[model samples]
Every structure is written in structure tokens, then in C-alpha cells.
Target: MRRSSVATSFLLVSALGLTACSGGGSDGDDGARKAAEGLATALAAAAAPADGASTPSDPLAAVTWTGTDPATVAKEYAAVIDGMDGIAPSVEVAEVDGEADKPTATLTWTWPVVAGGDPWTYDTTVALADGDGWAVAWAPSIVEPSLADGETLDATTLLAERGEITGAGGEKLVTERPVVRIGIDRTKVTAAAAPASARALAELVDIEGAPFVKAVKAAGDKAFVEAITYRANDVPAAVRTGIDGIAGARQVTGEQALAPTRDFAAPILGRVGPVTAEMVEKDPDAYRPGDVAGVSGLQARYDEQLRGTTGRSVHAVPADGGEERELFLAEPAAGKPLALTLDRRLQTLAERVLGGVTPASALVAIRPSDGSILAAANGSGTGGQNYATFGQFAPGSTFKSVTSLALLRAGLTPQTQVQCTPTVTVNGKRFKNYSDYPSSAIGTIPLEEAIAQSCNTALIGARAKVKDGDLADAAASLGLGIDHDLGFPAYFGEVPPPASETEGAADLIGQGKVLASPMAMATVIASVQAGTTVVPHLVDGVDVSVPSEAEPLSAAEARQLKAMLRRVVTNGSGRGLADLPGGPVIAKTGTAEYADGGTIRTHAWMIAAQGDLAVAVFVQTGESGSRTAGPLLEEFLRAAR
Candidate 1:
């Protein structure tokens, strides 16, 4: 058993009066043992000084000092171990043994140095004598065997190298990159000049100056208040010259984890900087003030794996200019790399294609061959949200694919004729085709032609053939409406059973309570291209389990769905993709109307599968899918090819 159990049993025996000097020692020996145990308890409670809190005046108060003043000894002991992070150690009396005239006690001290690390354990002996009373003989070596009277322990931290985040083919995505920290160094200027200098620096950096001035005023006398950090190449020469002219302006070079460009997958990869107070409070042993840690996104999700162990070295420095000896050392460990399934080139191209789109747009690409997510790009208008995998909106006519599947399972083939009209009504609610529905394809036509032209009334007219849960079941087969943990932030969308007749009619056109994300729409195309259900994933080595209750998509059904979708590109709203260079492109186009603050808006959506690539493009506010989102999708597919 450990020393704590032994100490507890000893105290229990004494409390129960079960033992009386079993070795036949004198009363003085018992008194010495009791005094040593009391000293151990105080030592265990003596924490190191933190946040300017004063050290305990006497941790050995229970044991009277015979050879030295107790207060002076206590003060010296606190000074020597001041650098050990003020962690209270577990101290216990290991044993008490000696001649009757002079007794000695061995104390076990265990210091918890790091999280999940081996503790520093040691044993030291303190002698007891009868000078004025049963007291302990004080010496500097009682705390630590190697300590001298005037030596102090100095702790030095060794920083660990943060790991890189790698993409497909082992390409480094997030890695250490050079940067310049521009700030106001208060040590170089008077207190009155610091705020002015901060304002000037902020102006030169093109940042707001008032907040910088306020922060500089609140900082310490010699603190360096950082205003901004810029990539080494991004800093302008004019800014550098202006900084040199300022009295307190300074620029410090450093390295930080960064992507290829400023907005390249920023919302997903996250960033790292100084550790916050909340992080320290959450895990005091793992974090401290001034430490750099991950703050958001995947960087925060796998922080421990990315931020390796920090090494430490404790040295005994002599006060009389003697040689210092190392008491302990722990070597720093480098963090492991986080692997992802994204293709860097494809992701860059996707972001570039969506660069001009406004109002929360997203483009997601998945490889149907293996279900690997190749790209998930958010447009500049997203306001820092990861809209590619999380944006929820009506999918519009793109959801007709699910309706087609439900009808196919209802014994309707691709060539089966369905009535195509200008408008259809359900329960006094009128549903009609898009504004520019071609007059050539409007009468009675095959199911494939109705899908190609995106006939809303045609699908709503046939909704009576399928039952209540048919849409949800068909959506599950196409990889929608089922949630899976893909080891990252994602929204798989919702497809519920229709609650009323109007809602059921609206379901046929992908509106009225139907919601889907760009990633979810991309997965639907990937599933059709794969001839089976496909689950998209980004992080490598993460297991994903698809729901077992949903009916699996058969190869025959996928083939029939692909045939109808191909006709969509050949003659329907998806005609924009007809001239692409890639081998056959199967696609669907959607334009769903929504009310935003009493003003009507439409969500433009386009999804297509070309060769092994499945892509989905969505524009929150657009006129039509073929006109707004179709061009961007074509550009990305052309570049990717």
C-alpha cells in the first residue's frame, strides 16, 4: 500500500487505542512521532505562492526547531522551491525509527508536475531532539536532500513544436508559417505617448485605432500590446516605414499554424494563439498564462494531439556564484499530424470559384468512388460560418430525385407517362411550375421528361401514388435524413413525414419543411453515382456508421435515377452543364422560394456527378439554379477536370 494508507491506519490505531508503544519506546519517542506526523500534514497543505499570494510563514509549526529559527527556516524553504508552479504536494510520514534519545522520521513527498506525467517522488529524514522540548533539528537539506542553505531552484520551460495538419496525398495544409506581430512596446515610450503610438500603429495597419489606444492604456508599464499579426509577405513597405517613424511601435517575427492563404479553409482548420484564462481554469495542469493553444474548429477539437508535451528543467542555482546542478529534466515531445481527406488543389479551386458569390453560399465536392470529401468551401459572404456542411435550406427541384426514387419504388419506370400541367392545387393551395417553364415539354410526357423539365405540378400530381413516409424513406436511401458522426462539424438535414395534404404536395417540389445542406445534397449525387448509399467523410481513420433501418439503394434503382438525371443536363434546367468536357455528367437543378423578413427570396442549388467527382453548389439568394449557381459549378468542374 501507498504511504497514505499507512498513515491512515496509524491514525486509526491511535484513535481506537489499539496500540501502546509496541516497541517499548519512551513517552518522548511517541511525542516526536506525533509531532512529525503533524508537520507532514502542514507540508502537504503548503501550496506554492500564486498570483502574489504570500507563502505560508511556517509549514513546520507543529515541530519545534532546535538548531535554527523556525520562521527563517520556513522562509528559506519557500524561496528555494518557488519556481515549482506552487502545486501542493502529497506529503506523508513514511516511518518513525531511531534510538530513544534521538528519534528520526522519514517523510515521503510526491509532487504532481504535469498532466498524465510521472510524479516526482522522494524521501527525506528529519531528526528529533529534546532541546527545551521534543523538537526537530532544522537544516536546509530536510526539504530536498541536495539543497544548500542559499541555493534556489530555477525552472525553465522548453516549448514543444506544434504538429501540421495534412491533406490528401500527405500534403501539408496547416503548417508553421512566418508572421510579424505588430504592437506597441511601452518600454520605449512614456506612458502618455503609448496611447498615441498605439493609435498611429493601428492606422498604419489599417485597423481601428480607438480600441488599440484603450488597450495600450490598460496594459502594464512594460507590456507589449499587440495590435495585429500579418503574414511576412503581406506586410506593406509603407506600413513598415510608418512603424519605424513611431516611437513605441515594434515588430516581432514569429511562426504560427496557417493555411495556404488567409481565407483558405479558415472556418474549418481554426487558429492558435495565447491561452485564455478559461483554458487554464479548465485544465490548470495542462495550460498556463502566455501559453499558445488552439481556439476553434478542428484545431480545438484535436488540441491535445496537435499540442505536444512541454518539457521542463529545474536547476539548483547557488547564491554564492557557484556552479548550478540540474535537479530534474523532461524532454519536449512533438505533436502528431492530423490527417484529412481533402485535396488541396481542388479545395483551392472551389474557394476561388465561389469567391464572388454573396449571401451565404457553399460548394461541396465528394468523390463517389470512396466517399471521401474533397472540398467544402464557403463563400466570402458567410461571415465566418462553415456554411458548406452546416447551412440548412430548401433543396427545391433537386429533391425531385428523391421523389423519383419513391415513385420508382411505387412501380413507375423512367418511361412511365405522367400528366404535366401548368399548375396543380392541393387543399386550396396552388402549386405551379417555374416562371419560364418551356411550353414544348408541357403536356403529357414521360417521367424522365418531367424530371428533365423540373415540372412541379407533374410531381405534385403524382404525389398521391406514394404514401406518407415514402419521401423520407427514399431520401434515406440516397444518403439524406440520416445523421452520422464524420469526426467534424456537419448537418445531415431533415426529412420528416408530411403532416398535411398541402405539405405533402410541397414535399414533391423540395419545399415546405424540407431542409438539406450542401454536403447532404452532394452526398445524394455521390450515392447515385456509386450505385449504393454513400456517406461523406473528411477526417481520416474516423469510423462512420450508416443507419440500418433505411432501405438500401439497389443498383437497378441507381441506374434508373442516373438515366433521368442525365436527361436533366441534356434538355432541362441543368443544360448549363451540357457542354462540360468531362465524360457524361448527370445532374439536377433547383430553385426554391423562401420568405426572408416578408420579402421573397430563392435558394439556387445545383448538384452533378462527373466521372468520380460529385459536386453541389448553393446560392442563398439567387434568381434561378441554372443562372446563378450553374455557372460556378461548371467553372469548378472544368478546372477540376
Candidate 2:
């Protein structure tokens, strides 16, 4: 019984295992058949047209469409297949209703034409596909290829905040714009007989008769042109009537007009002109025609700061046969005003002081503490001729100050004994003093007395004791033989360093080869008065500033120099200045002989401090310093104070 039971259990287990395996196989077959049927149905549906039509009117009825050229589409498809190397599944076209006329029937996409924050409208044409979406048809226009690299369109007019040019006490010296100008449009008087038009324009505008007729004829060729000349200060009341008389004439404000001052400081202030081609070629971005620029003095120096940046705009115009449009526009820029360090009172004083003297005389005054050029006035020569900085003459006895300083630095004192002989011989040359007086009458004199007396012999005798290089170095330290770098052109006054020992001896007496400008001589006296070496400045503080590192002289030396200079006014050559009412004056005088062998014609000079101001005057082809230049300095000093 146990064996029979074991046999039945084994048969039952085998039967159950076989039955389970067969059932598993049948379920796998069913699932495979269902999946195959679903795929076949999808393929058939994709290939067939809508509504069960046998064939469609369009060749691309069963496939999604895009606007791209057929060649590009083919290339993209080939590229995708090559990229995948046949490992990816193949793509099939899908069909939809009205696919023939619709390029992207099943696809939808959002295309952005104009970029963000753009105010103008843009035209964008996009292509669509079945499921891939859309792309831009063309790229943004790169229209500036013909222009030079980095070049762009810029506005012609510029607007800027002007600075004020004021006097020393902060009073306004330069005024701002206060009026507007109205111009007539001369081009539109197109009547067959324009006599009435011209007469009407003359009535309304400032121009008249022949000029008005000429302007109208010239402007007729231009579309919109301004009259050659317009009314300044105010618009004429008749302009409205004149414009009404003409068919299409108009009255408007012109962009260019005169500033209100009417050339108050004309030559000094300079004028503006159109930019030239040479300037543009040198710097492509620097300037354009019809732009105003500084032509002289302070104007030229501070042009960059005075002139400012320009602005821009747009005016739209309709494009031909299209929805797109064109734009045309511009914005103007204004200029900045300049503030000067000039004292108007002092300038007027200088002009008056220079008037009585011949046109050859020149004068310059400056403040010592800061090297601020207070006044500069020049007598006439020619156009743009300013002798104050440009004239070169023998400095004469004024150079004695430099010679004395050299002697002092070389261990000589005011009491140093120096014989004042009529003539002294050095290196085979005989150099005579200014006068032919005997040495007995002017024996050994004190250095201070020699300077006060304007004794040429004493100065040359004293200079003999010092080396040539020392005198040159001393004179240079006092601002000789070097350009002061003032805004305008200045001659450094030729004091060629002595080439030989013989030339050196001649230089000592203010003879042979010593030259200086009136401006430079004034600077020397100012240095002595201020007790420090200073460069004379012009154009206010724009050209130069006081050197932060300059060291001043000792108080004792300053006091001694001041005392010696004072004696020159009270008891010596400059006694003409002694009678002035205000206060004590200190001065020096010079009468330099010309190289042309005439009588002492050009008087070179120095007028030291009178109260707070110092003045130096030079008169070419004039009398002695005392007679010719001293009186002018005295007159100026009294007026200046």
C-alpha cells in the first residue's frame, strides 16, 4: 500500500509541473499577439488619409510639414540618422486633416519677434512642424557692414552745463545766454514774381533789400534753408506778416547764433569756426563741421571741460510697400561756461597804464602767494601781438638783481667792498660801465649802495668774483632762460649760458648776451618780494600752480633784500616813485643799449613791490628806465592800489 501511494504522488506532481509550464507559454503568446495587433493598427492609421479616402490631393498628406527647403529637411534627417548610427528608432510621418494646404497642421509654437523692452514693432516669419515646433525664418539685420569698424551714427548737437568765469572776488566776469534769435526760411518764396515775397520777408526779418534778395535766390536751390543773416537780440514783429505774404515761407529759430555779450572779450575770448577735414582725419571721433571750438588763450586750454556730450532721438517714416518703417532723428547738446581768476579792476588798470607809452611797451602783474597772473596788457604791434609775453629785450640793470643774488650766495654781504671803475678788463676784453665816471668819485662802495645807485661798474666788478656757472644758475632759479608754460606762447628770453670765460665777464654787466621779457622781469621782483622763487603764470590758474615742494627763503634774507630795494625808491634811481601818496615803494631801473649801435633806445626795467603789488615795464626804442618806464610803472601802481 505505501509503494502504490508513492507512485500516485509522483504522477500527480509531474502532471502539475507540466500543466503549469504549458499555461505560462500560452499567456506569453497571447500578450505578444495583442502588442503586434496594436502596432499594426497604429501604422495603418498613420499611413491612411482622414475620412477613409483612398488618395489625397496633396503629396505630403500623410506627413507633417514645415516651411524649410526640401534639401535642408533631407540634410537634417540624414544628419540625425548618422548621429544615431541606426541604434535609435526610425521616425515616421503623421497625417492629419487639411495637411496639403497647412504646412504645420499638427504643430503649434510661440515665436518671439521683437526682443524684450523694445518699443518698435518687428516682423517675424516662423516655420511650423507636426510635433517638433517652430523656428525663426531669418536672423536680425546686420546693416552696418559698410561703415568703418567701431564707427556709429552720432547726434550733431550736444548739451552741457557751463561753468562760470568770475573775477577774483567772485563777481561774474562772463555772462550767460539771455536771448533767442528768429531766422527766415528763404527757400520757399517760389512765386512767379517774388518782389512781394522779398518785401514781406524784409518787413518781418532783420535783413533787407539787396541782401534779402541775394539770400532768397541762393536758398531757392535748397529744400529748407536759413537766411544768410538773421535779426539778433529779438525777433522782428513784422516776421509773421511777411511769412503770411509768401506762399510757403516760414519763420523759425536757427541753431547757430551769437552769444549775448557781443564780443566783450573778443580777442581774448576767441571765436569759433567750422571743423576742418584735417582735424577729422587725425581723430575720426573728435569733431564735425559746424562745431564750435576754442581758437585762443583760455578757450583753447580748457576746451574739453567747457564742451560737453551730445544727445539722440527717432522719427519714424513709412517704408515702401511694406508694414516696416524708417526712423530719422537727433538731439542737441549745449556748451559749458568757464570761470576765470582774473580781476577786472586790475585788468582795466593795466590797460590804462599801458596806454600813454608807445605801442612797444608791455606790462605784466602776478600774485606771489599762488602764482596767479592778475593782469596782462600789451601795447600794439600787429594782430595777436602781445608783447607782455612775446617781447625780448636786454634786461639791463634789472639783471643786477640776479647778479647781486649770486654775489650774496657766494658769501658776499651788503657791505662787501667792490671798486666802481669806469672800465674793467677781462680775458682780453675791455667792458665799460654805463657811465664813464672816474673810479675815484665812486670809490669802493657798499653792495647795497651800489645796487641802489644802479652802478654798472660795481655789479660787473662784483660779478667778476663769482663763477659764470653760478650767475647762470642763480638767474635760472629766478625764472630766466626757461619757458613759464603759460597758456599762450612765451619766449624764454635768450640768456644763453656763457660759452667761454670772456662771454661770462660781459654777461656780468648785463651786456653781451642777456635778454628777458617784461613779464619775466616782473616775476623776478615778485620772487624777491615773496621770498620764494615762482613761475609767472597766465590764463589764470589753468597753465600752472604753486609747487607744493618749493621752499621759502629765511626771514633775515628777505628783510635785508626788501630794505635794499626800498632804498632804491627813496634815495636812488627810482626816486620818481617816492612821491606816490599811498605807502613806501621799492624799485630798480635799467637803460639797456641796443645792439644796433644807436643811443640807449630800449629801456629795460624793474619796479618792485608798492604796498602789495609789483609792476615791471619795458619800452622798446624809448629813453632811460627812469624817464621812459618808471613813470608808467608809477601810474599803474597808483591805479592798481
Candidate with the greatest TM-score versus the true structure: 1
How far residue 366's Cα lies from its native spot in candidate 2, in Å, is: 1.3
Report the C-alpha lDDT of model 2 over 457-527, residue by residue, as the tens digit.
Answer: 67766655687467766666566666646665566565677777767766765666888877778777777
Q: Compose the digit string of candidate 1's lDDT tens values, residues 430-474.
A: 999999999998889999999999999989999879997889999
TM-score per model over all chains: 0.85, 0.60
**Segments in model 1 whose C-alpha atoms lie over 4 Å from true places:** 1-28, 48-63, 66-75, 95-106, 124-129, 135-140, 180-230, 234-254, 284-286, 318-324
All predictions: root-mean-square deviation over Cα?
A: 5.4, 22.3
Q: In lDDT terms, how accurate is model 2? A: 0.53
Off by over 4 Å in 2: 1-164, 176-269, 311-337, 425-430, 433-441, 481-494, 537-552, 595-600
Clashes in model 1: which pairs? 48-86
